[model samples]
Target: MQKIKLFTDSTSDLSKQLLNEHRIDVVPLSVVFADKAFKDGQEINTEKMYNIIDENGKLPKTSAPSPQDFIDAFKPYIDDGYEIIYIGLSSDLSVTCQNASLASQSLDGKVHVVDSKNLSTGIGLLVLKAADFINEGFSSEEVAQKVRNLVEKVETEFVINTLEYLHKGGRCSGVQNFVGNMLKIRPVVKVVDGGMILAQKTRGKRKKALKTLLKNALKNKKEITEDRIFVTHSMDSEGAEYLKAELEKEVKGQVIITDAGCVISSHCGPKTVGILYIKK
Candidate 1:
């Protein structure tokens, strides 16, 4: 039987170690600062992006890879006679999936593109699920079907330290209530149906927001997968440690922690944290 290949974009925010462990192929998105552009994980890093955003008072423009980029990444695996599955970020969130879809046309039916309908570690969870199925000797088609089934099962949400980034990035204009009041209103944002939606709102205090995050998780703990849980943060290493400890106490499996990548940080800003997992 031919080997199965798994691919994801940098927006998945998977760590280099995790990607290497699974031998997962990754296509990078671009974070552009004016005329200059840098690869998501290669040329520029999350820290540099955050520093630039701080100094510039604006978020850098993020762009998905062109079809050519995905095409190049797909060709090698397809040439190796291995079936290809490219799991992508949310369609509503970015054009990454569309690019992957366009690239799929170059290959035969051997290449499959899946819309994770998620971003950050939400996308990572689906990729891991596909890897799990492949490890069980499942075919590419089987992996695709299994991952798609797990897509909705994977729940994703985050709490930003402030909504300033959203306002500065011109994303949350409609939520003018949180404009100047972001310091006092910490909204728990969730990924639902391929878009970011406000899940809950708490006090301006970071601790309050964290409690809300943990509260929601505990309420829904029965539905979350017990195998692995991801605690993803944009900086906030200390907060990630606390969140990971709290999560490990409630979860049966290992708690994997990762810092969100530059592309993701550009939108959410710094000091943001999220807990991601698949449903049981």
Candidate 2:
């Protein structure tokens, strides 16, 4: 049987090391700052992007890879006689999915594109699962169906330390007032269906919000296992580590910590805390 190739973009928040270890391919998305453009993980690093955002008072805007970029990325696998499975960030959030689909159409029948319906490690987690299925000898279609089913089961929740970034990006529609008025409140945001939704609002401090986030994660703990919980942060190492420790204490299994990439950090901003878990 021919091996199946798995592809995802930087929006998945998957690290280069992880992608290499899993033998998954990643197409780079473009990050634009002021007038210059850089490939999401290729041309710029997360620290550099965040530093620019901090100093410039604006997060760099992001763009999906051009159809040609996807075409070029998929060509190698097709040449190697490997079937391609491209898992991308939610279509509702980015045009990456559409671009990948268009590229697939151009590839004839060799490439398959899938909309993860989630973002950050939420989509990364699904990519990891798809790789597992591929290794288990599942066909490309079977792997795609499994991913689609699991995408619905996975959930993401985050707490932004401030709403300045959201307000700046014009993504503050649902949580604007609450985030603006309550300086003491930390709102927990979740991905519902295909969009980001405010899950709960609470006040106190960052630590308290971290605690609340984990407590809420445990509410659906039965669906999670040792290796399934993914904790991501936007340049908030201490907070990410804190959440990881808390999850290890509460969850029945091990928790993994991943850095939020430029694509997600652009929206969530720095000091954001979040957990992506597969729910029962």
Candidate 3:
């Protein structure tokens, strides 16, 4: 029997410590600024990405890793007689999973790709479960199937501090974006069916925005798996900490906080925060 190797993309928003501790690998996407590119978790880290966004007052563009990048990552584990299971970001949101699927075709069945249908710690939670299964001596195929089943149950929600990033990135209309910025209308968005959509809106300062986010996103906190909660942020430590404190009262378990990697940071911008958990 061969050992199972776990992998995921940088959009998983998993910390390097977590990845290294689990021996999980990541294929990084590109965050481009002014025609210059940097790998998500490598060349450009989360803090640097956020600082650049703050300095330029513009959201950087994010590109999926090439199929070749997946190939490069998959080959080593395969050559070492290991079966690879790569859990990737949502296909509806990014091309990362699509490229990973394409790259697996060349690995002669040694590599298996799981389209996580999620992002941030949404993908990270699935990857971590797969790793647990592997550690428990489950086969790669079994681990993949179990993790895939958890996809629809994962919940991810975020509130943007400002509409400036979304406006600059063309995610929202300039007129509404301008007005929202003027009036300080922070938006609360949720991930549904692998796509991000506006679930609600809140006006006023950061505290009010966060209050709305917690209420809207965690309305069904009873449904969340009691084992763990993930709070991922883009250089928003204060917000993340506040969220963590709030979430701790809802779920009696571990709440891990991680920085959103470059790909997620590029779109989410600085001072954005979110919570992820699996539904029971």
Candidate 4:
């Protein structure tokens, strides 16, 4: 079997250490703030981006990687005589997947691209699974199929403290005014059918929302196990830690907490709490 290369974009939200350990290559997207652009996860980090947002009163806009960026990332593996698989964020969220496909078209069939149909640690989890398969000496095609299967099995749940951020980001236009008016409403969001969709609305209290997340997650405890539960937060370590403790009490397994990076933190804003569960 030929050597295989694993590729993913910065939106996967895998930390630098994880990426390095897995030997996964990342193509970075751009974050533009007030006419200045910084490479996501490269020149800009989560803390820096949030500080800028705090001062500016608005989050910066994010841009997908250009086709050339993809080409530059993939050319090395192709030249090294290895088959390449580029896993990326959802097409519904961004065009990074399409751009990777386009760039691979010029690589003469040496590269394959997959849209994870999810974002952040959702994509990160898939990439990590793929890396394990690669370490097990799986072929590129086999790893791609495995990633596709896993994508269909993963679920993400999030609770936003306010609708103001979603409204500003144009994600909650229809119900923005109504949801915003009700100070008691805390939006519970989930990734359904490959897109971020509202799952439930509860009172806007942090403790109550955390309990709700744990309650919902326990409903499918059979699917969750020691290695598959992930909790992510945006500038709210305290909230995340609280959720982590609560989740441990509800589920009989260990949980990993990931900080929402620049790409995801830009949209979710600060104090966002979420979990990603994959059924074994």
Candidate 5:
């Protein structure tokens, strides 16, 4: 059996510790500002990105990594006689998956790209599972198939503290942004069928919105797998901790807190917290 190697993009929002521990390779997406471009999680981080956004009052443009980037990342492993499997962010959200596919075509079947159909820790959850299957002696093909099957089982939902970022990113209209901020309306964005949708809107403070998100997640606890869950945030340690503490009381899984990368934070903005897990 050929050795299996795992690859993922920076949008996975996985912590460096997890990436190093699992031996995962990451191709970083670009976070472009009006003045310069930085590699997500490398040249820039969440706090610095947030500060730039605040200073400029503009949301940075995030671009998917080029096909060449994936090719370069996979070439070293292929030369070492390993089959590569790359799990990327949702194709619906970014062209990162498509670029990976293009890169795979040039690798002579040594690479398999899986569209996570989700983002952030939603992708992280699947990548970790792929690592587990590979460690259990599953063939590269088997590991890819097993991870793809779990794509739809992943549940991802986040609460936005403000609509300013959404408006700047063209996801929300200026009027909606104005009204939402005026009313302190927070929307819970959920990943459904490979796209993000407004799952629910809560009118009140951010605390109320976070509680609503927690309630929605717990209501489906029976279906949630007790393996591992991720609490990913963009400078929202308070919200992440609240969700983690509440979730730990109900679910047996380990709740991990991770900082969102620049790519994710550019769109979601600061104080955006998401809970991601695979369902049984």
Candidate 6:
């Protein structure tokens, strides 16, 4: 059997330890400011990006990796006689998946690109699954197909603290942003069918909104798989840990906490918390 290599982009929001342990490679997207551009999680990180946003009062523009970037990332492994499976961010959200597909075309069928149809640890969950299948001696084609099949089963939702960032990023209308902030309305943003939607809204403090999100997640605990769950946040350690603690009390699966990457943070803003998992 041929060797299989795993690849993912920075939006996966996976920890460095997990990436190194699984031997997975990453191609990063870029966050562009007025005068400079920083590779997500590479040249810049969440905290620094937030600091810049605070100073400038504007969100930086985010860009997907080019086809050449994916090609460069895949060439080394292909030459080493390994078949690669690259799981990237949702195509509905960005063009990263398309660029990866283009790179695969030039690589002579050695590279397989799987659009995760999700973001953050939602993508990481699939990458980890692919790694497991590869370690269990699954063929590259099998791993790719299995991951693609599991895409729709992933559940991604976040309780955003404010709509200012979303408005600044051009994701929400100006009037909605103003009214939401005025009324202290926190939104539960869920990733559905490869795009973000307002799943629920809570009119109160941020903590109350988080609790509502937790309640909704736990209400369907029976359907949640016992593999793993991710509590991803943007500079919100308290909220992430709160979710982790609550989940550990009832969940059979391991609950892991992670910081959302710069690209995700740019859109969601600080104090954003999400619980990501796969459904059985």
Model 5: per-residue Cα lDDT at residue 260:
91
Model 6, 1-280: lDDT tens digits are 8888899999999999999999999999999999799999999999999999899898999999999999998999899999889999999999999999998999999988899999999999999999999989889999999999999999999999999998997888999999999999999999999999999989988889988989988987998999889999999999999999999998899899998999999999999999999999
TM-score of 3: 0.95
* lDDT to native, each model: 0.87, 0.84, 0.85, 0.83, 0.92, 0.93
Q: Which digits, one per residue and each the tens of the lDDT, describe model 1 over residues 1-280?
A: 7678899999999999999999998899999999999999989999988888778876889899999998888888888888889999899989999988988887888888899999999999889888988898888888898888888888888888877888888866746645537447777899999999988877766888887887787788878877778989998998889888998788786799998999889888788999888888
| TM-score against native, each model | 0.96, 0.94, 0.95, 0.93, 0.98, 0.98
Model 4 is weakest, by summed lDDT over 10 consecutive residues, at 174-183
What is the C-alpha lDDT profile of model 5 across 131-176, one tens digit per residue?
A: 9999999999999999999999999999989899999999989999
RMSD of 2: 2.1
**Model 1 spans with C-alpha error above 4 angstroms:** 173-183
Clashes of each: 1, 2, 0, 0, 0, 0
Indicate the TM-score of model 5.
Answer: 0.98
lDDT of 3 by residue, 40-158 (tens): 88898978877887788777888898989889988988898888899988999888888988898899988788888888899999988888888888888899889989999988898
Candidate 2 clashes between residue pairs 3 or more apart in a chain or in different chains: 226-253, 226-254
lDDT for each residue of candidate 2 in 115-174, tens digit (9 for 90 to 100): 988888899989998988998999998999888888888889988877767777886754
Q: Give RMSD (Å) of candidate 6 vs. truth.
A: 1.0
Model 4, residue 244: displacement in angstroms? Answer: 2.3
Residue 10 C-alpha lDDT in model 6? 98
Weakest ten-residue segment in model 5 by summed lDDT = 261-270
lDDT of 1 at 40: 94
